[model samples]
Target: MELKPIKTRKIYEEIVEQIRELVVRGELKPGDKLPSERDLVERLKVSRASIREALSALEMMGLLEVRSGEGTFMRRLKPESVIAPLAWMLSIEKGTVQELLEVRKILEVQAAKLAAQRAQADDLRELEDALENMRQEIVNPELGGEKADLQFHYAITRATDNKILILIMDAISDMMQQMLKTSREKLYQGKYTPNILYSEHAQIYEAIKRKDPKQASEYILEHLSGVEEELNSHIE
Candidate 1:
């Protein structure tokens, strides 16, 4: 490999590009640790600060992970990481909330259907546990109900048994968790009765338990539709 001298004013970016190129060419494979900061500085003929900045940028891009004393390592890239930045940016734009709701509806409606068809006994038990947790947290003020709500949906996703679907769901899970908290808070404020939410979730669980894909899909879609309506009405 040619150790080219850093000649650009944007030295940090140049460093980032070179390392990125190495990664692309498989010179830096996933889980491979990089040379230390001092070694990188010497090899790239750039300041230590520039190397640090490049490493930081790579970390933010989900391409590398830095351990406090273990050095930086290339991460096994996921498609979700590539789309995450765009997904986050869209989340902040006007009209994006509805878009998120729509995406949630699509992914979850199908997940419900798949779970209905494929859920094993353990998967059904997980859903039951999540629902019971939500019921017990009905009066909780610390968002416990919301956490259970997220878990209920996650259990459904797990039942789908599709790795790609699971990855996509996991990718958007953080944002969805925040949204679920806002939704539970609104429900607590009496925007909608808590019983309605509980009953609907129970219906979803029952549909999956009975292996009724159609009912499962319908129940979940109806649940999402109600949430979207309430959220839109309360937003502004």
Candidate 2:
């Protein structure tokens, strides 16, 4: 309700930023209806067109929902919805593949450690299932095992039971999948075999299953660091 007038070339982006800031500040909450376009126009000193554009963008980002006759209401923000635009942009940026791997190392190493400490029986079962799927996919020439490999990593994050970490994982899922596929292809072309990949994942799983956080972290780091080295060698 304390909106400011827009004074920029990109009026719509500014409007979106202001609205997003309001949401971040806990002023506008989920299920709260936004002011009408005419009211927003008066408040932001922007044209109705700009307001509409901003609102439309927010809707597309899953931040707002427009009812047929009930105006626009803020949607419950999901981690994936909030960070999806960043994922899309990163997907298009050049020379980010290595950076993505770096991020994976940071997030996944800690994920493995926390999973060892916090994983429940269900979490262990999920990890085991993913590992078994990876083992089965090793002999399936067409399947490539990338999906199972990604699932294995996702299961580890779920075991951690940390919502923010899980949110970050969900947000970068597409990029992660692409990274897996690309790196696997590169490694397979050289000396890495599907069985070798399966073994690495199995070791990580065993470490987590034993509730050995240190061993789990070491195994995961070793696996990822090797892959990172392989990726860098190809890139260079």
Candidate 2: C-alpha lDDT:
0.86
Q: Rate the local accuracy (lDDT) of all candidates.
A: 0.82, 0.86
Q: What is the number of residue pairs that collide in model 2? A: 0
Q: Evaluate model 1: give its TM-score.
A: 0.68
Candidate 2 has what TM-score? Answer: 0.82
- Give the runs in model 2 whose Cα sits over 4 Å from its true position: 1-15, 35-51, 76-95
Per residue, candidate 1 scores C-alpha lDDT tens digits across 9-111 of: 9887678668767866778888999998998888889888888887887788788888888989888888767544444434444345577789999899999
Query: Whole-model lDDT for model 1 versus the true structure?
Result: 0.82
lDDT digits (tens) for residues 133-233 of candidate 2: 88787667687788888899999999999988887888788878887887788888765788888899999999998999999999999998888787778
Instruction: Tally clashes: model 1.
Output: 0
* Model 1 deviation from the true structure expressed as Cα RMSD, one decimal place: 6.1
